[model samples]
Target: MQINQLTRAYRYDGIDLPIPPHLAGDPQALRAYHATLYPAILNAEAIDVGVAGTVHVTEYRRAVGTKG
Candidate 1:
């Protein structure tokens, strides 16, 4: 349940959960991989949460004319 921050090419804001080695390189595969792992991670209480019982969420946005 340890979420690791990933390196980005430019300044942007987002949540970076480390993709397990088994899910490397493929975005579609990663989604499936997470589908399997997330339940376990949540069961283990590895997910962050908000004060009112919501899962902690993050947002990513591009600056005025900057690519994100």
Candidate 2:
């Protein structure tokens, strides 16, 4: 008899980039991923994470239109 285990991680971004478990759990790595998803957050004055793990930009300004 043989046993095998497989685990997969996908970045929160819709692009489906594979993420290793270690990087996913790292706070700094998580922030980089977040910046990739919402570039505006790079300049955001404040950020809030909800109980459900949702990220909210509490304060930000846009030169023109906004994205993300």
Candidate 3:
């Protein structure tokens, strides 16, 4: 017997944010909620997990620029 796990997270401002349980199933809704907290997420990169290993991962990467 084998089992697979699915994980989703948001990377914003160099931090990993966990998705709210209520919005975990709905990507669009999750985005809306997250956008409210971090407006930059509105332009975040949504990456879906490709088939490779047992644990599947979905990541939302928000490109935050640094002041130099």
Candidate 4:
């Protein structure tokens, strides 16, 4: 899946993937989009770990953010 940073949207095989407007520039949105496309991109050359499913944005912020 390829994401157009400017639009904060994704596309697979030239087909555009629908993502919410609020999620623009947010990593969590990226993760959710990734999960939905996993089955198709499983054989892709490179996919990062920890991006396996449609996890909520808040959870991601808590898990990855620094309290300081």
Q: What's the residue-level lDDT of 38 in candidate 1?
A: 48
Q: Candidate 2 on 1-68: residue-level lDDT in tens?
A: 96544333333322334455667557456546656767854554433322232322222333455667
RMSD of every candidate to native, in Å, equals: 14.0, 10.1, 4.4, 13.8
| Candidate 4 residue spans exceeding 4 A from truth | 1-8, 41-68
Any residue pairs clashing in model 4, and if so which?
Answer: none
Best by TM-score: 3
Model 1: per-residue Cα lDDT at residue 60: 26
Q: Say which prediction, candidate 1 or candidate 4, comes out ahead on lDDT.
A: 4
In order, the Cα lDDT scores of the candidates are 0.38, 0.44, 0.71, 0.43
Least accurate 10 contiguous residues by lDDT in model 2: 49-58
RMSD of 4: 13.8
- Candidate 4, run of 10 with poorest lDDT: 55-64
| lDDT of each residue in 1-68, candidate 1, tens digit only | 87655431211133355556655656456544444634332222222232332333322232345445
Reference-based lDDT, residue 28, model 3: 92
* Better model by TM-score: candidate 2 vs candidate 3: 3
Span of 10 residues, lowest total lDDT, candidate 1: 41-50
Per-residue C-alpha lDDT of model 3 across residues 1-68, encoded as one tens digit per residue: 97777565555565666688989889899888878888877887877645445544555676669857
Candidate 2: Cα lDDT at 18: 41
Q: Name the better of 1 and 3 by TM-score.
A: 3
Work out candidate 3's RMSD over C-alphas. Answer: 4.4
